[model samples]
Target: MQDILYNLMSTEFENPWKTIRSRPIYDNPWIAVREEDVLKPNGAPGIYGVVSFKNKAIGIVPVDSEGYTYLVGQFRYTLNEYSWEIPEGGGPMNEAPLETAKRELEEETGLHAATWSELGRIHTSNSVTDEEGFLFLATDLTPGPSNPEDTEQLIIKRVSLKDAVAMVMRGEITDSLSIAGLLKAFMIVSSY
Candidate 1:
């Protein structure tokens, strides 16, 4: 695995597909859709539809000194199901991801932290979307009143980091960002 990753990182490659034409399919404040006509690497013509996001995504796991972390529960319209995830939201393209993480953490959980560390970065649904996400670990938390956005009706739950990892393993938390963030946090916290 290390060899493969090393080769991948050390190699320089160019895009194999040549774009022949492109057109917009949809547009909104949050997302824009475009369809492109391309010449494939195999020299065949193809069309690809891509969803572009206007903002980067940020997910935060606020862990107090007691090893307790917070989760936000809400109904996800696209999935038509309720999801339990770490405090997450969109950061404007021009904004810093850390600032976005701080704002989202406070807005969704009413928690402020004195220390922050980035867990990892992920691309959510790479095949269909160009949405990028950053995960954070927040410690030394102080709680206040939550100020969720108008579009959000959220339920906040506090759980041990271990329990949160179990929820991810049990498939109770399926959001990609949450699952990845929690699992990474579990590994980092367990080492200490």
Candidate 2:
């Protein structure tokens, strides 16, 4: 343990700096790219893939009163297929991460929670993406009326925790933060 701590302290956290072209390379709805040269940890210089989005959003692990996990079904535009995923929406720009999670949970599934706790924040796609995702756990839920947007055709469903994990493993659910939040929630609840 001491050696591990010493090794952790000895590792450099700084990345070598490089010159940038000082101009916007590409601008689009999802992200804007700026031309930047990066010096690698080994001192090699190259162009880096940088993406700037508005911000990441929040995902909630909604456990119902019956101890079942609430999941949402919707077609992902990118994936072009219907899949099971935890409800997630809004971002830091619209509201607080926790507030966003609450809003999204109510908007998509119409389940309101009396208690909420943030598990933590996740950095989604850190390799070439600049999105920070928030993870939340919701409990003491009561059913409410859903108000999905015109573009959304959401179907709320409750699943056993065991089956939910199995769905993810079977590739039936493919959302990133959903999988992460569900796994975390399952671990926490299962410990007791």
Candidate 3:
């Protein structure tokens, strides 16, 4: 099965569309918007707008010995809504993802983990953005003081891993990275 899947993916499929030209539409420290002129798969000419992220998104699910995990609640300006999610932040392109996860966990929840394992990687909003994301499972936690950024007004919560999974099922946690990380963590813990 693995070989079949690998062969399928490794097979080079010719790109269906042809790019005519591209130009920058907007630019910022966090993201850049670009417009591309392309010939569609069906030979129609069209324009495509893509948002490129300057940093990789990192999420961490920090579990204590008691089977509990930490969550962070904050108001998302873009969504204009309050969101509950696992500790997450943008990792600079030059920095390691695990290091960013550790910083985010400590800054948002005041917890530091001695052990870390990668959970998964995802491409968030692949249709419109080039934002890549990574999730980590952190354990052996120790408490410390939180140092959130001035731009962040965050609330911290601790809940059982089971309850976190329930939140995901109930659609209470809509953040993609959080849902993915929590579900993976649940599976990892359940195997123990």
Candidate lDDT values, in order: 0.95, 0.83, 0.95
Better of 1 and 2 by TM-score: 1
Tell how far residue 2 is off in model 2, in angstroms.
7.0
Query: What's the best-to-worst order under TM-score?
Result: 1, 3, 2
Can you give the TM-score per candidate against the true fold? 0.96, 0.88, 0.94
Per-residue CA lDDT of model 2 for 85-180, tens digit only, reads: 899875656667888888889999889999998888887788877888999989999999999889889888899877898888998888889889
**Model 1 C-alpha lDDT per residue in residues 92-133, reported as the tens digit of each score:** 999989999999999999999999999989998999999999
Q: Write the per-residue lDDT of candidate 3 for residues 109-128, one digit (tens) a residue.
A: 99989999999899988989
Candidate 3: segments with Cα more than 4 A from true spot: 1-10
Query: Candidate 2: TM-score?
Result: 0.88
The candidate 2 region of ten consecutive residues with least summed lDDT is: 14-23
